[model samples]
Target: MTQLTTDAARAVPTLSDEQWRGLLEVRATDPGAVARAYAARRRPDPLLSRKESLFLVAADHPARGALTASGDAMAMADRRSLLARMIAALENPEVDGILGSPDVVEELLLLGALEGKVVIGSMNRGGLDGATWTMDDRFTGYDADSISESGLEGGKMLLRIDDRDPSTAGTIEACAQAVTDLAERGLMAMVEPLPYHREDDGRLTLLKDSRSLARAITIASALGTTSSHTWLKMPACDDPDTVYASTTLPCVVLGGVPGPDPAADLHSWGRALVQPTVRGLVIGRALLYPPDGDVRSAVAAAAAVMRAAHPGAPAA
Candidate 1:
């Protein structure tokens, strides 16, 4: 296996070679260490502060075969590199938490990096990117029971609605059940819903129109028996106010694939954060691997946006 290491002088404490070897030894022998770590993990005070805004770094895309960054197709293919970047991003105190798959979350937990952080488990990744069955986004990751057992703050699932794809129904049903299960445990159920259309070339195209996005919001909001504990992870669309107004459920804007201009992207997110219903940000690659390759700077800039949106919120 590849060994992981990071500069000790760096702000983030990357997994040293010794730590990596130790983790491997534990997994090789004491496989129960992960659960034990979770059981003994320390937690933060309140999940949400008075202002209710948050900033969760996302590191779950790689499990879905979506790893492109800065036009590099294989930028995230290296596990060590990905984890190192995540650690660096989390080093910024402004970063409230992370949204990651079970594997990533466990690794962070084992490293004690998740201490006092809001950890949200990713619940689905069966719909691999560029695959023929991409519309069938099954719940192949963290389930509600496991998330609850691990004491995570919430569970996240991807919901893609394709009018022409029958698999969409199965995903919807699964997500609804997950929502109910999580809610019953008094945990948050974050659903990311997108309207999709498959082209003749078998490529899935997301509908970015405000109406289509709003329709997706309505569908996701109505899932499960109740919406009291549900949160929407929505895109920062052109008309975020109009799209977000479709549902009363609190929302966190998703930082979609990064563009060439970081300022413009943050500007869009800032605009979306202005919406009363849009609580904060759940972003990934954009902030983790910015054009300038400074995770702290990127995260701080993003936190500034959140602060501006919730002027009365306590500082991070």
Candidate 2:
């Protein structure tokens, strides 16, 4: 049997070298052997490691009725295939972390993956697109305790405030409580805020003005118990300068739907990636399951943008 080294033991603090070695020694054991050994001896740490900064690909759209890829509708409708492709992409060396709905989290957990990986649970799915309840985002993912129990690092939620829509107030209050809960549990909460309005035709749309975006961010940043664990996931406004003024909290760009030219999309993403306060991207259908059906290539392209923006930067 291969013996575990001291450094290896330190790297995986949940298990001592001798215990890890013992587990490895039982090679002919049943399929549940490793799991039983892990359960018996390991206590996984449910904290985010500071070694790396991550480009968290968001594949949580299905829960929100966003199943399109580029121009193709129903792109993410297939759950099993999507999970397989996501696992493959995550296996890539350059890939770092994930941001997805609770269903996605359950899928990853059942696959016996996510160990030593940054797992961010999607906390909102009630605000389905085109629904009357779109403005009232609700927490539907892992709570602080569930996140800790599942060994997940953190969770994320969306906040789209449409002043014309009274539901926005409910979302605001819910978000405040959620943030307080996450902070008290020492879990990170990534919040994406949008100041939007429903047009006469009832199509929800974001205001193009920077002032609205800034105000929205400020309103979101002020929510929750502590601002320390909150990250603002904002969209890059028409004027890049406005992005810098939006919020003081650590921010990340939310990848919009992919365009006709993926290369151009990558370039635009690269530009957003270069923003000073922009930590990284929380990309969804754009990167995970592209219209092209090449998850590896799409993820690589996005990873390239991240690498170009912050060369040799560590994953978060």
Q: Highest TM-score among the candidates is held by which one?
A: 1
Which candidate comes out best when scored by lDDT? Answer: 1
lDDT for 115 (candidate 1) = 90
| Per-residue error (Å), model 2, residue 123 | 1.2
Candidate 1 displacement at residue 264 in angstroms: 1.0
Query: Could you tell me every candidate's TM-score relative to the true structure?
Result: 0.93, 0.81
Q: Could you give candidate 2's per-residue lDDT for residues 1-316 as a string of tens digits?
A: 1234565423211223553354345544554554443233322243322423456767788888878765657657866566766776676666556887766765555455555556788887888877877777877766777766655667788898898888889999988888888888887888888888788888887774778888888898999878888988887666656755666777878877666677877877777677777777777766665555666777778877777888766653
Off by over 4 Å in 1: 1-14
Estimate the lDDT of model 1.
0.86
Clashing residue pairs for model 1: none
Over the stretch 71-136, how does candidate 1's per-residue lDDT look in tens digits?
778877867667777887888887888999988898888777899888999999999988889889
The lDDT per prediction is 0.86, 0.70
Colliding residue pairs in candidate 2: 52-314, 52-315, 52-316, 53-314, 53-315, 53-316, 54-316, 58-283
Alpha-carbon shift of residue 178 in model 2 (angstroms): 0.6
